[model samples]
Target: MSDGIDDAKRALRAELRERRQLLSDQARTTAEEGVHRQLDALLARTDVRSISCFLSTPTEPGTRSFVNAAIERGIRVLLPVTRIDGLLDWTVATPDGDVTDGLFGLPEPVGELLGPIAVNDVDLLVIPAAAVDHRGMRLGWGRGYFDKTLGSMERCPPVYAVIYDSELIDEVPRDVHDQPVSGVVTPTQTIVLSPQRH
Candidate 1:
């Protein structure tokens, strides 16, 4: 059973990667606007005081607009930094700041390392994913970064995945170590999963 699940996951990931690569510049721009609108609505609905998100890379969904909006609202924003042990460390983000290259070429906050905060302290976690399902299962980039980080937390915050609307599907293959998400924000909609499962 586990082997079958693993194979399905691998196949789905490959498909998602191919689809992501096919996105044209015009499509990407349109998708970005849609994502921004959905995210703004989600933010308005919640009373969250602080958020932890990532710095975007070219291949990843860009987060500049979301980060800027959070900063403008005076919401404390945190970005993930990779630890030497292949884990993630959270630090607050600064306006127009520089970041050093971290694991998998992801950027990390460079100035004044704020150490790390307990995961429970974060009100919302904006997670990146290759794809996510309506049931809250997320398929990551296969590095196990967020999985390990989420597993290590004693008390977890609400995890919200950001993806293109087309990437949201009926289901995703899961593993024992996989952590379910609380919600997902796509270009078209904000999907809130049932709280009982997570």
Candidate 2:
């Protein structure tokens, strides 16, 4: 990653984080519901029996409702648990599962700790992103956790980033280690982008 592109990504992530923080309560509610619908729509198109997803922070597009609903539907949902080794552990999401702040203060489920490779069996992946460009490039929050997970997968499933409608932009700065998603699920719609090859 060039210093120029890295700097651009840092600035863009900050702006996107600020935008999320500024959302009104009503707007957040609506966006949360919209996210639920879009996620359901994504599931309708894919034949996933199990999936991997992140638990969103309050400011991010909400996924908690959908997680509960999926659990009710008997789908195995793996929630990411951050490990200190720069890899993610996993836990099965239960209805009303206990959540504690993991590394970087991200919400993580508390349960049986599955090893890092547990994600490999998931039929789909719904991850978080600061922004996703039209061509599927994902700009994360600089931790590189999701990027590394995707990169290490032997046969990655259809990965999608959850973002607000406006965060879907024309382009985003990228580096060699950045992993492209197969699509994006926004409050308004689900867009399939051509995933880039490393």
Candidate 3:
């Protein structure tokens, strides 16, 4: 990554973090509800039997309701379990299961890991992103966890980034290793991005 692009990304991440933190309680609830409705409708049309998803933190676009609903529909939902080496392990999450505290303030699953390559078992992947551009470029939290995971997959599924509507912009600063997603899901809509080659 060039120093200029790296600097811009740092600034953008900070700005987005502040925006999330400033959301009011009422606004947050409304957004979560909206996301739930949109996501539920999106899932109804897909034949995905298994999914790889992250357990959202408070400020992120909500996924808890979707996860529970998927499980209820007999879909297998795998949640990421962060490892000491910065790679993520997969674990099956049940609606009633407990989420214990994990690294970087993340809530993690309670079972033995299915290992990093376990992600390949999923039919679809819904990942976290600070911002995703119209060109499908995803700007993640500085750590290269998701990028590395996506890069290592031998036969990757369609990966979608979950973000607020406003976070889907014209462009975001990118590094050589930055991974692009196939689509983006916001509170109001699911956008299918055109394919981009590295």
lDDT of each: 0.79, 0.94, 0.88
- lDDT string, candidate 3, 58-121, tens digits: 9998888888888999989999998889899999988867889988777787887899999998
| Model 2 per-residue lDDT tens digits across residues 150-187 | 99999999999999999999999999999999999999
Write model 1 residue lDDT over 1-198, tens digit each, in one string. Answer: 388987998899899888888888887777777777877777788888888888876656667677878888898888888777767777777787777788667677775555555445778888899888877888887777888887777778889888887888888888877887888887777899853344
Q: What is the lDDT, from 0 to 100, of the residue 42 in candidate 2?
A: 86
After TM-score superposition, the amount by which residue 100's alpha carbon in candidate 1 deviates from its true location, in angstroms, is 3.0
Worst 10 residues of 3 by lDDT: 36-45
Model 2, 169: alpha-carbon shift in Å? 0.6
Candidates ranked, most accurate by lDDT first:
2, 3, 1
lDDT-superior candidate, 1 or 3: 3
Off by over 4 Å in 1: 195-198
Off by over 4 Å in 3: none
Give residue 115's lDDT in candidate 1 (0 to 100): 51
Model 3 / residue 129 / CA error / Å = 0.6
What would you estimate as the lDDT of candidate 3? 0.88
In model 2, the clashing pairs are none
The number of the candidate with the highest lDDT is 2
What is residue 158's positional error in candidate 1, in angstroms? 1.5
